[model samples]
Target: MARKLTPAERLATAEKDLLLEEIADQSSWDQFLVEQAVFHFGQRHDEWSCNDLRDVLPELGHGFLGAAINSLRGAGIIAHTGRTVPSTQASTHGHRIGVWRITGKGRAIAAQRRIARARGRAA
Candidate 1:
């Protein structure tokens, strides 16, 4: 037999569902962080090594970082330079690392997002 929920219980259940939805959206938030990182690199006009990004965003797991960067590359948001730098991590045994640069499209997207963010903050 199913029990009926009181009004207060229904409200609590709705809030719980909302919280769960927010939690599920965290992946999107992390993706946004990855985009922001690439945008920052583009704005600086500097090629960013994977290790560099990892260092800057230590809170993001290595797997997530790799996947995020891969997603960006696949989406044409970032391109890899031929130049390789030594990995900052101790685990690398003389293996070179690829450097990433944001593409023109990425730059334009970043700029637009920056302006939007500024406007949002002002509002």
Candidate 2:
């Protein structure tokens, strides 16, 4: 069993959730990032990190992609793969970063989106 969150921790969690929702609502970037990360990298590889995501996503500013990825994980779209690797960014001095993989839920949603896109194009 895990320790329950304190009031401050709970408040911080709520604040973060609201901010992530606002970021998603403000533009299409969040959805695009999901597609690019889930379909692009998630399809070709079994595991990835923000390094891989940042490589493909040109629009998100520093820290934004990390936030988005956290949101995705919260939504059950991706999960830690029980692996870690040194970040390729020289700025990090090879710090360890978590590896992640798309969850079944993520793959299902991607398939549904693909079908919808196909139908839209057909129509």
Candidate 3:
């Protein structure tokens, strides 16, 4: 007789399927980077700097965060609010900063990621 699959095994299979689906649906690397920036920014809807995103998403190449931010802006996934110097840079950079926040579309993408993660966990 065939053995029944364990709950953990089932979950792993489900997660793998979901990951494959995501990979197939995702666009190019630049697009993924832009989406990631939007999703992360959505978590902190408040304005964030390029460095902030870079720190959180190390997978992104150096200066790639800025490119992602620009791409997101073009896609209307994020918008610039203004800039402020963080405490760390207030002295050296003289408070030179650029602020950005996610848009409605960005929120939608973030919601999708949450749903995907939930589905993965449920499986």
Best by lDDT: 1
Give the 10-residue window scoring lowest on summed lDDT in candidate 2: 7-16
Local distance difference test, candidate 2? 0.63
Q: Pairing residues by index, what is the TM-score of model 2? A: 0.65
- Superior by TM-score: candidate 2 or candidate 3: 2
Compare candidates 1 and 3 on lDDT and give the better one.
1
Full-model lDDT for every candidate: 0.63, 0.63, 0.57
Residue pair clashes in candidate 3? 11-123
Please say which candidate is ahead in lDDT: 1 or 2. 1
Q: Compute the lDDT of residue 93 as modeled in candidate 2.
A: 97
Worst lDDT run of 10 residues, candidate 1, spans 7-16
Question: How would you encode candidate 1's per-residue C-alpha lDDT over 1-123 as one tens digit per residue?
Answer: 446433223222312223545645554556545654655665686688877777777576555677667767776777898888988777777588888898876766666666766766798
